[model samples]
Target: MSQMNQPDLIGIADVAAKIPAFLNKIPNLLHGLKQAYLRTPNTPTGLGMAFEKAVLRNPDGNALLFEEQRYSYAHLNAWANQIAHFYLSLGAQKGDVVAVMIENRPELIATVIGLAKIGVTIALLNTSQVGKVLAHSINLVKPFAVIAGEECRVALDEIRHELAIAAGHFHWFADQDTQTDAGQAPEGFVNLAEKIDLFPKFNPSTTGSVQGKDGLFYIYTSGTTGLPKAVIFSNGRWTLAYGTYGHVLNLNQEDVMYCTLPLYHATGMVVCWCGVIAGSSALAIRRKFSTSSFWKDVKKFDASAIGYVGELCRYLMDAPPSEQEHGHRVTKMIGNGMRPNIWDKFKARFGIKEVLELYASSEGNVGFSNVFNFDNTVGFSPTPYAIIEFDKERNEPVRDTKGHCKRVKKGETGLLIGKITRRSPFDGYTDPEKNKSVIMTDVFTKGDAYFNTGDLVRDIGFRHAQFVDRLGDTFRWKGENVSTTEVENMLTEYDKIVEAVVYGVEIPNTNGRAGMAAITLQPGSELNEQDLKQMVSTFKQCLPAYAIPVFLRIQQQVETTGTFKYQKNQLKEQAFDPQKTDERLLVLLPNATEYCELTQEIFNNIQAYQYRF
Candidate 1:
């Protein structure tokens, strides 16, 4: 028998063990299908409607768990209604945008729900953003009102003059117990919490008129490429996400989802919260993610599921093993960016039964989920998508003579494009030009459009894909394309390395950028000569010559976005320049077995086009 046809006993045993889990997915799949079919297109399917439905089903059920406080579904709904009424009284109307800058708290959730109820689109501003970025994000949306928590008062105050909104429209709410009445309304801001008492705790009639196609959220991109772009998150897309996770994941009222991700991110706000609402379950939220507090919080809340980004999982693995890490109530985790290197290890260590590793972006129409508890794959996407051939040099899709993009064969890495259809429409960014730049016209035929995902993925068969790297992140070295994600994954497998952010750096007199990695060592670990040699040896054995990073920058920590995505733009720009950064630099010169220190002399030599990479 051919090796491909031969089934090993270990593989058979693993399959047998997963039989029950696979069988359980049937009912959930059917439920998802029913929900998808029943959703009324172009009609009102706002999150407010779903929240109301969830409240009706489980009025007394715990809806939100934040720090020491817990609010029931009815309680939360009433608070949302009160806020909705207050906003309505402020003359907030349908189709109006409201910029919201709040930390991850119950108030944030309540404010979002409240705004949705009043038919006001929310520009969910990142709490971490400040000065120019903050002002730019708010100005891009042009919101009529700006609502902020006391925690973000300083940031809002800093950019208040830059914003076009009136001073009276500025609102603030107190989240801290120490906050006084005088402190609540910082200078030009109104105290939103105080005004909530004047409004009735009843559902607003305006919510009924809100349609599925209406703007729901203006979620800003991670700003990995450049400035953050405001991406539209429509009610239809939100509802679809709700159905997929709630029904397909088989969440129930008994489940308590622990969400430590930022509330501004789509994963936390839409995916995590929508699932809780869809299943009428409880949500345990935190102000921010902390590795030390993660497991403890999970155990404290008796959480049955947790949300994660790849960095969170990595942070957990890097932390010292604790008694609290094991024997937790958590059985499932739902999120994206879980690397294959840490996948099995994270699951085994944490005692998690399922990891619903998903693949989706804020604005992209294509989405995938591992519904069958599959390992190392962003499982089946029902949406119409194509893995098309791309030109690495031009950084665009490869077009045929007919001017249509061609699809890649199975197991090939290619750019992912989602078909822009009526059912799965691409509700693009706030900037129309930015939207146009990503959409490929006549992709398959004349007049057809597809939303470019800006991600390169490997078709792993069965409609599944393994994320390779971002289109911009992949760089050419020695005339061979190198995947930054793939290189970083390999580097993290080394014992001494804790984290790695791989990028390409321009080399003097070189045809293309050379591979470079900024790595953080494990606590108390040092990159000695022996360690350096071992790293080189390991890379030689595991990766192709062209794929290996030519330079290594050792850092104390890796900078990440609020959502835990690695900040590579800065790293790429400041590559190996000793004058630009204080971090230690090491370089593997052509055919060198070990990495040598990149001193000022060597740096100058490389920059002056004296050395060839």
Candidate 2:
């Protein structure tokens, strides 16, 4: 729906005709603009402040919607206050961590706001994470207590036992029943619905309150490979996200934001919740994302906007052009990672007029939102954004003798880095050492520091930045980060597997990239599908769901450099098909656990839509 590139608009005559003249005039028009209108800074000081302001301004407005159930500003605030009072009764004080694990539900938002109101830090646990990984993530936060769903209670129980976290640490809320109101009362665990009625009346006070610099939440984001990193998200950053989406994007009160994505994700928390907090209605889906059901829900809810990552958009695009695609009330969308090739088609097909593409991080302070609703580019930001050339093989920037890092020229791809200063601070993880690892000091000169984004960006110029790819070995798969080293480590533990090199391979009709592993086995070891399946099952139990590899390759010996670095470029190019390379390859079929030899027939079927991932 945004501006289109010439080549991308070629098939659409109307769009193509306007491209040439538009391109020539756009740069000057943008350059001619003064700093007045476009110079808005990042989000405000705190999520609590934003919520208070919104509640005060629009107390009767609809705040959230789950199925047919709706919560107005008064209701949301009341529920949050009750939870805050309950936490206070439990000896919770400022800066105390309260872990929350739930799917997309009203309770999740209530608990977060409630905890924040009383200065309790919310630790967001990803629902997709289960078994050992989930347990590990919980332990990493070391929260005083966890507020989880009854549906999730079973998983949390399993995780609680595995991690040796105390059973009493859990506070469960039943999310399935909407008709049954569990009013504020002491139950087995606090019933979120019940707490609303019992919670004390709102008494706005600034004394003993959480502030801009205080921790708003802790989110465990995907690391390169291994356990996830618990990134500290301060209230200031949350305020910024709220301001960017609610004000900068100009979300109206009539807007209904349908949030099908998991609430723990950065996109959902900021893009989805921020809009709702600004007095717009929010439509939440409790179940897993289904492309077939997506349009139905949008129409049913009369959603005017939707939040997405690239994968979600592609799924919608693949669902045969339906009248419902453009028939819905949706006019605009805001999210990250829309691939350039499919950008125009996705926008037009969906009838989205403005794709407010953005670039940001859950832990980072610097972020960019498409206020101008530009195309291809993730728009632009007033913050300092730089793209510097990086050598993938060496895994370091190519610096000059003067020790100043060079920026990528226009249209060139490089590692993206953001200046880390007092104002644009990188308030990193709780672990100082872990924080130090991502921060690069003495970049341009002595004492200068920058936050390593760990992403590759292309400089399109004109103050615009385009997401090219991710740097290093970590790749995003289905909106989750898949660490190559973590996958390789899990694979190599198998007795038959001597070594493994993991990397992302381009898959047809997918978001980010699909994970594939090239493995070498011990001498004389036969590549058995049964054994491979067992290993994969072990991985499923031990690792997070997103970390599992989709494709596998068996080789006699992995190609490596003299410095013992695995050569992944060639392996990534080969992918999983047997015809692509002589190396024996196998893939985990659609619902099957065991891997099967990648035959040309099966491979073609996969490419031609015979198999569904």
Candidate 3:
């Protein structure tokens, strides 16, 4: 958007429109903020306190809704309490890390809260992780114990020898709800379901002592070095999200929030789930996101709110329109990664009243929320943050001679950096050296530091901004920035393409890398002559000449991380090399109107600069 148009996106009236609700919520919001910032060991708001509040509010009311099960606040709380007492009996102590690996279910939520209530830092291992990655994540934290679902038993067994914990430390919960029928436990594994059955159903006394600074969960994120890094998410930070986003949702106990996203991710567990707990409402969960069963489950639960990521919205939009989709009670959505292109379309199609698209990182301090119900914005940060000029090619900030980074003007793009303070603390990676690499000291002044977000954002007016791209995924090309999102967006618009992952690939002797895309096509679609021509034509018509992907790799599916984020590093490493990958490669040559199969001869010529991109 232009400078003249930027002001129209959000203004004084927009903020004023939300003031009435804001005024009504002043006391609660203030209390939440106080709990978030104050470093109190007792009475510090955390997961245990928050859930207890909901349980006390209405114990008989629905707290969780899963397949064929409606666990009341009282029931879930009691179950969690029993689990807590059982672990406590086993000498579990506060501040001890307990690694948990479970798929999305009520069991997962209850298990985490149970341990968290006792002040144990839950190391949330991604369920999709297997073998080496799974073993590595567990050993990274060196947890005191392991609690896993029967579904994950094979994976745990595969890497059992690699783990540091003794065989007796492993506890198993049946894949099905183990409450009614304590299912058989795997050999040598303690049956948590059967063992905890005899424990008392009362809140642990240690709940009050979980300080604000205490680690709540350790979430693993992809690292620059190709391994996963454990990021600390403190009770303080989680409370900040709880108080901030929970109020933004403005849900009541009557509401139901449906979340199908992975629980291991912060977006679902901390953000969406907290919103439910904050409202003292029911949280309806699914094993996984399913387009076919989404509306069916929504109607079944009468869900008033839903959770989403960018791709989830797109998938829903693409699914055949059904009577079940529209006229539902789902009036709100809360999650990040909803692109500007689909923001309005998603709302209009689903009759959604609010799209609370937010931006936050488990590793970073600053967070942005869509407070004013603005469109296509990541909203504003209550904490201090700056968008500064950066060098994309050099992959660093462009600092002035005075040793201060320059802030981008409104309607300009720049790297986002959040100033670190007690209020906005960057509880970065567990690796101290890794943390040092991201913290920029002396950024704007002699005695200041800022956390690099590794993101490119375009500033709109009124403290709001639009997400541009991940700094690493975007590359400088032909003296211009080529974001993968830009190319990916254009490519996915084609009818044949189901998903597109774009990245920059180096050509021999080139000043900047050229654009390449790995695309997964629709079912029954093939890379035939006519389709290739139309795809190239669409690229020529819709995208910039330089932005057009010079190379294409046809893939059956795109690999994604546990959080549904594209695993681009692997794709970027492989590039479009025919020799490196057995997958078919195609290229659009100089002045070509259609894409053709890339052979060894064509690949060598391109490397030799026989054809210019």
Q: Which segments of model 1 are wrong by more than 4 Å?
A: 1-20, 177-183, 222-225, 473-613
Q: Please give the CA lDDT of all the candidate structures.
A: 0.81, 0.72, 0.83
Better of 2 and 3 by TM-score: 2
Q: Residue 346 CA error for candidate 1 (Å)?
A: 0.9
**Winner of 2 and 3 under lDDT:** 3
Misplaced by over 4 Å in model 2 are: 1-45, 162-167, 178-198, 201-208, 279-286, 492-498, 520-529, 532-536, 557-562
Instruction: Order candidates by TM-score, high to low.
Output: 2, 3, 1
Put down candidate 2 lDDT per residue, 328-358, tens digits, no spaces.
8888787888887888888777788888899
Tens digits of lDDT, candidate 3, 1-613 = 5676755456677788878755765776676666565654344658998899899998999999999989999999999999899889988888889999999988888898899898899999877666555787899999889999998888888888998997788999999978787799979799999999899998989888887788899987756543467999888788888888877787788999999988888998999988898889999999988988999999999999999876678668767899989768999899887767778888998999788999888798878988767888898778899999988655689989897899998888999889998778888888999899889989888999999888888878678888877766566454234557757866887899989888888776444568899999999888788977998887765554667898999999887656234357667788877888999899988788999999989988987867745
Residue pairs of candidate 2 with colliding backbone atoms: 43-240, 182-194, 183-194, 184-194, 224-483
- Give Cα distance to truth, residue 223, candidate 1, Å: 5.4
Candidate 1 C-alpha lDDT tens digits along 252-316: 89999999988888888888887788789999999988889998999899999999876677678
